[model samples]
Target: MNPSKTGLSFLWLSAVAFIADLATKYLVVTRFALYESIDILPFFNLTYVRNPGAAFSFLANHSGWQKIFFIVLAILISAMLVYFLFKNNAAQKLQNAAYALIIGGALANAADRAYHGFVVDFLDFYWQDWHYPVFNVADIAICVGAGLLALDAIKNGDKKKSEKKA
Candidate 1:
């Protein structure tokens, strides 16, 4: 199959990811109480937490301006991602996937912020006395997408160098 054709498929992946993120957030909100924790394993738990700011609760302590800031920022970023996805060549499958994932995740979180003034988080991982920040499906998508983009950059760079030597 042509790699360039993969870009269109990535758009579908974005839709699926957005829907899944919304579905999971709905379940968590309806079934769990705020700050409630349910142990699923020795190292993981479902913990309900609201983040009004960016990752790691950045700017969460501010006087509520961050909510508006993040909502607008997410919208802008998502638009940019969509533009990039369309502009990207078909052979850049990984890059297209990266754009799709980031766009989907951004929209999901932005929806939450618009409706609830914060993002709903539930998945939690911890060990012994240390605990990682709670997150949700949207966060996962964004992180994975960003990683893929980085990998694509490195791979493309290598390809260019190889071509130059030939």
Candidate 2:
């Protein structure tokens, strides 16, 4: 099927997200020393660091095996997102965009995994002595995409309920 006729066209967004992720990571990796941090705002910082595991560095302290597992998982999820977009109508704009962002983020992280053996995280947020995990552009895209998807799901559920009652 022609990509322009389907949600596949949203891959442009994927390309943008992927490039942004890579560029930011490159800058952080090249410009900063490991664990180096620079404050951007009272509650935010640009701290360069490496993550060996998924979100919040889950299983980061594990042996070398988590790298392969995460890389494979990212590939599988990216494929699944593409499949979901390919199989559906372009009218599902919310889902399409969501899938595209996830695809871009997953692939970008996978690339980082294969190249750096870790995901580069730099956007840091904190309040007082407490700090949130450092993350990057891909993480932001993935999270925003996920939130959009959830919002869409909730909206459709409401629509379905209203239709059922009519």
Compare the candidates by TM-score and give the number of the best one: 2
Candidate 1 regions with alpha-carbon error over 4 angstroms: 1-9
Count of steric clashes across candidates, in order: 2, 0
lDDT of each: 0.89, 0.92
Candidate achieving the largest lDDT: 2
Q: Against the hidden true structure, what lDDT does model 2 obtain?
A: 0.92
Per-residue lDDT tens digits of candidate 1, residues 59-103?
988999998888889889988877777667777888998989988
Candidate 2 — which residues are off by over 4 angstroms? none
Per-residue lDDT of candidate 2, residues 34-152 (tens digit): 99999889999999999999899998999979999999998999998898888878888888999999889989998999999999999999999999998999999899889979988
TM-scores of the models, in the order given: 0.93, 0.96
